[model samples]
Target: MAKILVVDDDSATRLLLKRDLKLEGHEVELAKDGEEGLESAIAFKPALIICDWVMPNLDGVEVCRRIKSDADLFATFFILLTSKVDLDDRVQGLDAGADDFLSKPVDPAELLARVRAGLRLYQSQLQLSESNRQLSKTLRDLQKTQAQLIQSEKMSSLGQMVAGIAHEINNPVTFIDGNLSHGAKYLDELINFLHHYQKYYPHPVPEMQELAEEIELEYLMKDFPKLLHSMKRGAERIREIVLSLRNFSRLDEAQMKAVDIHEGIDNTVSILQHRLGGIELMKEYREFPRVECYPAEMNQVFLHILNNAIDAVRQIHEDTGQIAIRTFPRHDGWVEIRISDNGVGIPRGLVSKVFNPFFTTKPVGAGKGLGLTISYQIVVEKHGGKLECVSQLGEGTELAIAIPIRQHRPPHSPSDSTPDR
Candidate 1:
């Protein structure tokens, strides 16, 4: 049984509809004009509304227009009752959002059937709308999951390369360190022996001079220590960078844990050191708390952001551009890391779409735009943090990430969520 509102200017017509609809096991309400029908529809919220085309205050077409405008009220089935059988009148009624039209002197059986049909359509539309909303939500989740999976696979591949590169670099660095130490120690003994000779005889004695000449003391004493010290320092620095790269990759550790964030960043820089030759790199480190995170995933985030910065700088200058990386502690107990570069800044229009996956500004294969996108996921979704970028067209770009030291980290996504296959 449905609630039906009958609106008619004629008392006889309204009375007829009320009596006939009630006989069909429906609850019916009667209104005198279009104005009254509008008010009744708002107050009663009927399942179906039956209204006459012509009325004194407001006409049926106007009533339908007003109801339809209020989508909540329009959800109910609206049927226009009319005495004019002309095509024009029927067109006007339908245009006003009327679901059905019943001509004057209507058969009660036909009216009942039309009402049932409109009711079916209204329910079906509501169901379809709900289904569409669910489908859209599911699609979004799937896209996000797919993006995370691709990002993880890319990081894994990069990690393997980083480990191999670091290992290769370590060999030469170790050899250099050993040789420098040996040379430096030898230089210290020679310097002491020279000082003792100078003390024993204000100038070299005839016999001592002959010994010195035979040993080539002049050449050895001149520049040997200085050269060895310089070489050692350079090699040690390279060794440190290689170690940092290994720490950054963390290929052995897949699960999340507490990590010193600075080490991960240093490794990223070391691995990317070759690319930095064309650009000037600067960093300012601030005090930070140890954060619990997946070191490998976070290193990937660093790689992505730094890679973007490097690319941006490459645009404006052929060489000698600046990329600055700074990290500081925030009052909220979160850490803020910012990478800013004086490169070709992003255009105003392109800023909004940067985080969208597979969107690249580079020509064809030169770039895959997923760097910022994947970085955004790591900082914001995985670690319960935030990532943002500020850029101007010609000046440059600044990418900032803020993450809590301890957070309720989001679990692995469905796409990255694999089972033994």
Candidate 2:
């Protein structure tokens, strides 16, 4: 059924039209004048409008012109009702966007025929609009999928390369670490032998004494051990870096495991060392059990939140910026990690849109804007976690990430294998 509005100053004409349209199974609304008719058309968005040509304050042609001018009302069918029979008058009404005209004495059959044709046209317009909306949605979905695929491939390649580098470095580091202990032992025995030889033959030959002094033998004995110890420390630090790299690239481990949460967070920070040059990092960690999760995927999530926090603070304060990371256990099965920064914060109005796909505050070409979107899927979809942000504009931001100790392991997690930003 179609909704039609009839506007007329005459009470008899209005009632007559309403009564006849009702009998024909069309819903009809009565408007007393042109002004009231325009208001009703806007409020109800009727499919058709019939207005008297001569009404006080606003004429039917003026009403029709306004209706056609509005984009939202373009689908509405308008008809001009008048007793005027002049050819010029008909031309004027048509120019004002009137679809049909009715004589003042109004034939019921002609009115019904015009209403039927107008309703058919309105239905066709609605169907076409719906099709356009669907097409737009499809296009957006395709773009999102293509972008995600590209991101996933890039991360996968990076992970494989990192894993390879870590493997190569690990072999050499292991060789150096394994030899440092024995090397120190040999240096100590040689030193002790020389010391004993000096004690037994306190009076050495003149040539030997000259040689010892030339070589700074006493200082060499003390400093050589210290030098070896320093080398040992350096080797240990290299080993730590290799381990961090291996853990970060966790591509080799496809299955879930109970892993150290603090270590994962540390690995992510270790990889971002270059960008964290001047910022201060403060960590407050509680003694908690290792979490059961997908190590590679969860590492990416930590990277996203922490990286964003670092970026937020680095904007205003170069050397003075601070980022604090805190972790604690909840009474429930969940554990919470909060990354906070004392830098430029997000605006309140835009905070809710942070997780939307392709939404970024950064300028064009600076970022892909997919970091939080991918993070949201990994934490909430794959691991059954909660991620939320609290921020005050111009002050700072804090993002809370909470994940359960264990998960049900969702079946379809397309975005969990990669890093995105």
Candidate 3:
């Protein structure tokens, strides 16, 4: 509906005009005079303006002139209605940016028709403006999706390469551990043989004793087992690292099943524990309800959000900071997961744009700024729930994900809601 602002000095005129516009199903606001009109115009930002031409202290002509002069306000249509009908008066009103003029002793029919005409023009402008806005938003979302697709492909390739590299390293590391284990056994046997020899002979000949001393047999026999144990330990560490890398690159199979939210959080934390080594963690997990979800995708969501909170804490706090994670059931029958960190919080202005993909304050290579954005899509768009955050600069940030205990369809299936479509 069009919002029409009526500006005139006469109280009777303002009331009648406002009442008439309202009866026609338009939202009507009034201003006492040109001065009040100017203030109302900026504040209300009406779609159309119906202004009287003559008034004291800021006349309608001056109001029109100022509105026309301001580039930002020039798009507003101004209709001037006044008693002035001389050629010079008409010229002056037109020059002052009145889109149309209506001479006074107004006919109610003609007034409504002219107002209708202005409303139509205003509506046309609104439709065109809305179309432009939608188009621009669509373009931005398309670009972000394209970038995500490319990144996903790159990650897939990297995962494959990582698995192969881990496999290669695992082979040699396994052999090294096996060889050290076997060598340690052989040394044990050799030591027993020497003991038996000593027991059987009771006494060694002078030359044999000298030869054993020269070889440093005693020292080698004592330290060799410990040295072998150390080597085995080192090999075992390599084996564990190789295993972790393999797990990290495991393919994500799309499967919808009941998943434990707590378990997913545990796995996510375990995977990122190394990254969190420098930060202190405080967890308050309430008993949670399992929900139907794609386990792998859900895991990814946790990873993205948790990683972001960790990064934020690291950035803001020079000293070790705290990360608090909590989970509980909400009254809405949704499970609420909150991940909070005391670190450099988001600026007030940027809080609104955090989920705009690729919008990041991190250094160029530090981040791609898609973590929170992807998480938001997963919780809200994918699972039919909400993702929200409370943050203050220099204080900290809290990211909350509330997903239904049972899956929710958003008037349709979540999988069916494709961004491109």
Top TM-score model:
2
- Tens digits of per-residue lDDT, candidate 3, 143-204, equal 67965785577656866786789899999998898888789889899999988998899679
Q: Which one is best on lDDT?
A: 2
Model 1 pairs whose backbones collide: none
TM-score each candidate: 0.67, 0.72, 0.66
Worst 10 residues of 1 by lDDT: 412-421
Candidate 1 wrongly placed segments (more than 4 Å): 1-112, 126-142, 190-220, 276-286, 317-333, 338-353, 388-400, 409-421
List candidate 3 segments past 4 Å from native. Answer: 1-103, 107-117, 173-187, 194-240, 259-277, 281-291, 306-310, 313-333, 408-421
Q: List the residue pairs that clash in candidate 2.
A: none
Per-residue accuracy of model 1 over 107-224 as CA lDDT, tens digit each:
9889878878977887787788779989988886786678778877877787798889999989988987887888788779979987797887777669977998898877878777
Using lDDT as the measure, what is the rank order of every candidate, best first? 2, 1, 3
Tell me the lDDT of candidate 2: 0.87
**Could you tell me the lDDT of residue 225 within candidate 2?**
92
Worst 10 residues of 2 by lDDT: 412-421
Model 3 global lDDT (CA atoms, 0 to 1):
0.80
Worst 10 residues of 3 by lDDT: 412-421
